[model samples]
Target: MSLIDQVLARAAADPGVRGVILTGSRARGTQTARSDFDVTVVVAEQARPWRHSTRTGTLDEVVCTVEALADTSVHWRRYSFRGAKVLLDRLSGGIAELVDRQATLTAEEAVPLARANLDAYINQLYRCVKSRRDGLADAALLDEQESLPWLLETVFALHGRLRPYNKYLRWELENFPLPDPWSVVLMPDQVRLAPLCLFPAVESLARRRGHADVLDGWGSDIELIRAFAGAAGP
Candidate 1:
């Protein structure tokens, strides 16, 4: 049997291991030649934490209980499992289903998250510009660092999509992009260029969603940034 098959077979026979899931690049069909296998072993609530093992050269194992996996607050873990490949599921199939469900954002969750991220982006953008105006170059750079992620998250949540981890951002964009305008914001590398691309993208999204109120909250600041960014040029 192959190494992966042997590992799954062993996990299936273990009374303590209730389920086995394969995650990371291999599961996503994006693995490079150097990539290793990542596996999560789910145990019962009362069981001891199963030891993480790397006995096989290319396999890395993580152990957690169903309770931990079910906690939506553990977003990173949930995101990790969202695209997981089930190996052995002797736990009534609930683990696999839970992972799949958590991958998606409901309107209820997305709307508030979008608003919060939008507000945060505006706040950071304001600080960035203000710092530059005051000749605090270092402070402006720091604010720029803080602003981009919030801006990206805002756009993703507005579209009822989860913002992927930094490592997967390119993959997510290539596979499942947002509607036009917003899509180009992430393409640029310069901080000045970001606002130039992002402003119209956000405006387009707001107009499309009939969320005029969302843009209204930061309308003036956005315009000010847009003017400055426009003068800065590509």
Candidate 2:
């Protein structure tokens, strides 16, 4: 049997192992030939061998209790479990439920995240635009590059989804396109071009989602961004 199959079988047979979850690119079905199996083995307690994670012969293992895993679910690290595959769940579907929670965000959670991302994107975009106009080419390029990821985060938040990691950004976009105009610009062909055009759409979406006040906080920066886009033309 393959290494992963052997690992899963062993994990399943262990009475102490309450669950086994497959994560990373392997779980997402986007693994390259060089990809290693990322597995999480859940136990009832943090005892000897079960407590230490091991990386050996293509198997990358994390051993933790259910409570520890739950704690992880509430933080940014939760994204690691976004598409995790539960190979074994002795907890009667609890593992599956946890994975589901890890993959998405609630409306309350999404709004604050969206606001933060929108603020960050605007910060970078404003710097990029100002730098370009001031003849600071290198600085402009850096700011523009930095803004793209934050722009992506804002879009995902607007849809009430956690933004995928950079490695899975293209895969996420291809498999789960955002609504209409947003998706159009996020396409690989358009992502690098016409970033200024994004500000107006972001404002509209953020406003509709009760974030007009946050946008207002940016004050003249918003006006400057619009003017830059207008000058750049449709």
Error of 1 at 4 (Å): 2.2
Q: What is the lDDT of residue 56 in candidate 1?
A: 54
Q: Among all windows of ten consecutive residues in candidate 2, which has the lowest summed lDDT? A: 69-78
Top-scoring candidate (lDDT): 2
Residue 162 error, candidate 1, Å: 1.1
lDDT by residue (1-234, candidate 2, tens digit) is 987788778887788788889999999999988888989888877754335478875778889877777663355667788778998999999978877776768888888889899999888889988987899989987887888878888988989998777787777777777888766777756776656667788788889988888889988878877777666546
170-202 in candidate 1: lDDT tens per residue? 667667776664454564443234653355556
Q: Candidate 1: lDDT over CA atoms?
A: 0.72
What local distance difference test score does each model get? 0.72, 0.80
Pairs with steric clashes in candidate 2: none
